[model samples]
Target chain A: MDLRAKLALLADAAKYDASCASSGTEKRDSRAGGLGSTEGMGICHAYAPDGRCVSLLKVLLTNSCIFDCAYCINRKSSDVRRARFTVEELVRLTLAFYRRNYIEGLFLSSGIIRSSDYTMEQLIRVARTLREEHGFLGYIHLKTIPDAAPELLAEAGRWADRLSINIELPQVRSLKELAPEKDLAGIHGAMGNLSGHIAEAKEARRTPTRAAPPRFAPAGQSTQMIVGADDSDDRHILGTSDALYKKFGLKRVYYSGFSPIPDASAKLPPAPPPLLREHRLYQADWLLRFYGFETQEILAGGEGGMLDLELDPKLAWALKHRALFPLDLNRASREALLRIPGLGARNVDRILAARRYSSVRLADLARLRVPLKKVSPFILAPDHRPARGQLDSAGLRRQLLAPSAFAQAAKPRQLALDV
Target chain B: MYSVTLESPADFAGWREAARGLLGAGIPPEAVSWHSPAEPAGLFAGPPPPDVPAQSAIPPVPRDFLEMAERAARHSDPERFALLYGLLWDARRAPGLLRTPTEPRMARLEAMARAVKRDAHKMHAFLRFREIDTPEGPRSVAWFEPEHHIVEAEAGFFQRRFAALRWSILTPRRCAHWDGAEIRFAEGARRADAPADDAAEDLWRTYFASIFNPARLKPDAMRAEMPKKYWKNLPEARIIPALMQGASGRVRAMLGQEPASQPQPPGPRRRRKD
Candidate 1:
C-alpha cells in the first residue's frame, strides 16, 4: 500500500493509544512549505514535567503483532483488522501534513512483528529519514520496544526527539500472568539503555568534534502503564511509576486504562473499570508528582487502594487533613499553592507574579485563574476566609459527598471533578 | 459572523473603542480576533498622529512591538509601522484596566495586537542588508524581526544579533527573503497555494488521522473549540465525517461494559480500564 493508505490504516488502529502530544521544536513556518507551524494553537499539546498536556502527531507504525497480550486490543490473538507502514510512508505523511500546517511532528509506535529488533529498526528508520533525508527539524517521538536489542536501541535514541516504552501491566506478576511473552526485566533493561545513551549524547554535545551530538531526544523518554488489568492497587501503580522516574530519567509515565479486547483470557473479567477511576488516578498522580504530596497521602484520600471518584484527589486530601485548611494564600509556599485543587501550577506562577506588584485579594486570585469555588474552603485571601470550625474532616467529607437535592434519581450526580 | 474591521483605517485607540462596543453585546472573543497584520500601507505618515504625545513611564514595552517590527521588515512596510509606533506607544500612558466587561478585555487584547502590528511593520521597513556567497549564489541576510520599528528607534536589537549571520525576516504578509547579498520581496496576494482540490492529498489525510485522539474526540465540543470555518484548511477536517459516522460505535465503546460470556479465573474481578 502507498504511504497514505498505510497511514490511514495504521493511524486508525493507533488512535486507540491516546497519548496525544506534538511539541519539542520551536520551528515555525519560515519557508514556503514545511510541516512545523506554531502560528495557530490548532491542536498541539505538550505534557508539563508534572504531566499536564502536550501536542504531538501520536500514531502507530502498525498494529500487526506476534504475541497475543490478552489485555491489548491489537494483540496477535485478537480479531481486530491490522496494518503496517514502511518508514518512508510515515515520513511522507508527517512531512506533508506538517507542511500544510497540520501538526508539529510524528509520534510513531508499533506492534512487534517478525522480531523486536526488526520492528525497532523500522521505527528508527522513519525518524532517520525525516531528520537526515528531509532535514525535517520537527519533533519525532519513536515508541521504544522494550525487548529490542541494546545496539538497535542506540539507533532509536540517535533519531527520536523522545522515546517511550509502555510498561503494559503494572504489577510484575500481573504482567507475567497476562502477557506470557512479555518480561519486566526486558522493559527495565531498555529504559536503562536509553538512559545511558541520553547521558552519553549530552556529554558528546559539548565536544566540537562530536558532530553536534544531535540533541538526543530533548523531549526525553516516557512510559505508559495499563491500569485495572490486574488487582494492583493505586499505591502499587504509583510506586511502579515513581521507581521508573527515579531509576531512569523518564519524562512521563502515561496510564492507558485497560480496554479488554475480544477472545481475551478467561482469567480477565468482562466489564471495564469506571472512567472516573482513571480520572481519579490522574488526579492522584498529579498530587504525587507536583503537589509534594506523597503516594501515601494520595492513597489516603479514599476508603482503600481506590480513590473517591466523586471528589478530586487534592480536595479529598484537603478533607482528610482539615488542619491544612484556610491556608494563607499570601504566605503559602509554591508547594502549598499547588496542593490546592483549583489552583494549577501555571496559576500558582501567575499568582506569584501578580503578587509581586500588588497585594492579592480574593477577586484578584480569581482573575489570576484560581478556581475560587474549589479553593475557597481551603485558602484564606486578603478579604475572605473560610469559617475555620465550620466542618471537620468527617463533617466536610459528609457534606462534600452528600447527594445534591437538585439531582434527579435517574441523573448521575455531577461531581466537582466533572466541573 | 463578526470580524475586526481593517478595510478602513483606524488608529489603535479608535479600534479599541469600537471593539469594546461590539464585545459589550455578549459576543464570543473568537468572533473578532482576525484583523489586518498591522497598520495598513495607506496609513503611513511623515510624523506621529496628533493623538500620540510622548513615551510612557512604563518600565519596558511588550516584546510584541519588536515582533511586529520584524514582520513589517519582511513585508518591507516601514513607514506604516513607524507612524503606528508613533501613534500607539507615545510618551503618554495607556488606559488603566477597563472597569468592567463594558470595555471587553479580549477586545483590548486584540487592539493591543493591532498596535504591535503597526510598530512591527515600521521595523520591517527600516531593516538594513548584508551580502554573502553560497552554492546557490550571493544572498543578502539580516536577522531581525520585532513588533515595533525598534530597528530605527533606540532599541538596537538589530546591530547586535545580525553582526555575524546574513539573514533577514521576509515579514509575515510581505516577503523579506534575504540572500546573503541583499533582501528581496516575494510579493503578491497571500496564497497557501494548496493542491488543486484533489491533487493526491494523502499526507494531510494521514496527518489528520494521526493527530485526532479517538480517546478525546468530542464532536460538538471539538467543533466548538475548532470552528467549522477553519476545517477546510486542515487535513484532519475530512476525518470529521468518518468520525461522525463512527460516533455511535465510539460512544458504544466508551460506554460499553466488559464482555460477560468469556470464562475467567477466580481472582480480583479485573475491570477493563476502557
Candidate 2:
C-alpha cells in the first residue's frame, strides 16, 4: 500500500492512545548539530476536529497484532485492514514534517507482532536511528512493551525523551477477563524498573562530580487507562491512577474513553464512550495533583462514585463541603484560597501579593478578572460579605452551575485526550 | 505639556529613555503626550522629548513593575508609554501602588502586557513554515499577521530555536530573517511573495484527517485556539470544513458496521497459564 493509505490506517489505529504532549523535557535546539528544538513549552502546530492539540506525529509502526485485547481496534480478531511502515519511511516522514514545522516530533507506538522483544526492538531502532544518524534533537515518546526484557526497556529509555506503558484496564480482574494475555504484575514490574532508572539517571545528572550521565526519558513516563471499556467506576479508575502516580511517579495518566470501533468484539459492551466522564476524571486528576485534594475527597464530591456532569470537580467539592466556603480572602492561607471554586493557582498568587499591600475588595477581585458571580458566595472580601448562610441556601447550587453542553449527555463522536 | 515621539511602534528603549528623562525633569504623566510613528501625528505636537543628564537619578521601582512595563511597551496602544510613565511618577509617592491591581493605572498596564504576551505566544504556536528551495540550500518561509507589534521582539525565539535553518518570516508590519549565521530585518512583503503550496502538505493533510476522531467534533474549541484569522495560512485548514460536515455520517457508518471477527493468530493466551 502507499504511504498515505498506510498513514490513514496506522494513525487511525494509533489515535486511541490519546497522548500528544511534547512538554517538560530538557531544552535542546538544532543549532549545534540537530534538526529541531524543544524549549520547555510544547507547541500545538494544529488542532484536530476533536479539539485536541496535535503536538506530535503520532502513529504506529504497524497495526497487526498477536494479542487479542477485546477493547482494542487492532486486536487479533478485529478484521480491520492492516499495514506497516518501513523504518526508513517513518524516519523520512518525521524529518519532512519537522522541516515544515508541522509537529514537534514523533510519538511512535506499535501493536505486538511476532513477540514482545521483537516489537520493542523495532520501536527502539526508529528512535535510535533518528538520534544517532540524523542528529534529530526533537521530542520522542516511545510506548514500551511491558513484557519486554529489562535491558531492552533500558535501551528504549536511553533513546526516547518519554516512555509509556498503558495500564489498558483500571482493574486487574477486568484485564484478566477481557485481555487474558496481559499480566498486571508484569506491567507493574516493568514500571518499577523504569522508575528506578529514571530516578538514578536524574540523581547522577544532578551530582556535579559525576560525569555527564546519559539521559533516560527526561520528560518522564505517562500511561493511558481505557475508560468505559469495562465495568470500571470513576472511583476505581482514579484509585488506580493514584496508586500509579505514587508507585511509579508517573508524569501523567491519560484517560481515553472507549469510542465505538468498526470491528469491535462480540463480548465488548455496545455503549458509546463516556466523554464527559473522561472530562470529569481529568478535572479530578488536576485537583489531585495541583489542588492537594485526596482521592476520597474528590470522590465525595460525586454521587454514587460518578462525578457531577453539570459542575466541575472543584465547584462540586465546594458545594458538598459548604462549611469550607466563605473563606476570608484577606486572611485565608494560600491553601484555603486554592479551594475556592473560581480561584486558580495564578489568581490565588495574585491575591496573596495584592493582599500584602492592602485588603482586597470585591472591586479588586473584579479588576483581577476573578469570576465574581461564582466566587461571591464562597469568599469574604474586605468590602463584600455573603448574606447569612448564603453557602447553605438551597438555590446556591443552581446559581453556581454554568450552562454545560455536555450536561445533555450527547454520545461523543470519538474518544480524545483533550481533558 | 511635554510631547515625546518614539522611533518605532515597539520602541522599548526609546520609551524607557524618554520616561527616565521626563521623570528626572519632574514632569507629571498628565502633563505629557506620547506618540509613535505608527500613530497619527497631532496638529500641534510638542518638540521631541528633552534629553536626560548622563548621570540622572531615576527612582527605583519594583522588579515586576519594570518587567510589566517592558512588555506593555510593545502593545499597539499609543498611550502605553504615557501610562507606564504615569505609573512610574505615581509610584514614587505610593511606593506599593504597582503591587495591587485595584489601582486602575496598574490594572490597565497589566492587561496590556498580558495581551502582548498572548500575542507573542500565538505567534510561536501558529507560525507555519513552507519549504522554498534556494541557490544556497533549502529555506523555509512563513507569513504571519500578529495582533501586536511583536515581530522584532519575538525574533530571538525563532533564532534560538531554528538556528540552523535559513528562514524568513514576513508580516505586513515588519519582517525578520535568519541566514544560518546572523539575523536580519527586511521590509514587509505581500502574501503573493510566499510559495502557495508545498509538496509535504498533502501527507500532512492526510495525517490530520486520519488522526481526528470524527465522533468528537468541537469546531468552536478548535477555532478558539487556532482562530479563523490563521486558517487561511494553514495547509490542513482547507479540509476542516469538509471534515466537520462529514463527521456525523462517518460516526454513523462506524456505529452501524457489523462486527467482522478475523481468525485469531497464534497469540499470548496459549503461552499464559491463566
Q: Pick the candidate with the highest TM-score.
A: 2
State in Å the error of residue A131, model 2.
Answer: 1.2
lDDT of 1 by residue, B19-103 (tens): 3344334333433332343543233322212232233233243454434333332233323423333323331244322211112
Tell me the TM-score that candidate 2 gets on chain A alone. 0.96
lDDT of each: 0.55, 0.83
Q: Write the per-residue lDDT of candidate 1 for residues A1-419, one digit (tens) a residue.
A: 65566666676556545465444422344343322333212233211111112245566788889987777767887776677776766777666444432445688888888999989888888888887777675667788888888878877777776788888777989988888898999889888888887777776766778355655665567777877778887778888877887899776667766654435566675555554466567666656566687878887877777777677777777778877767787788888878776677766775665555455578876555444566777878789887657645447656654642211111111111111
Model 2: residues with Cα > 4 Å off, grouped in runs:
A405-419, B40-43, B257-274
Q: Which candidate comes out best when scored by DockQ?
A: 2
Task: For candidate 2, give the lDDT of residue A262.
Answer: 79
RMSD of 2: 6.4
Clashes of each: 65, 4
True contacts kept of 2: 0.55
Give RMSD to native, each candidate.
Answer: 11.2, 6.4
In candidate 2, what are the lDDT values of residues A101-150, reduced to their tens digit? 78889999999999999999999999999999998988899999999999
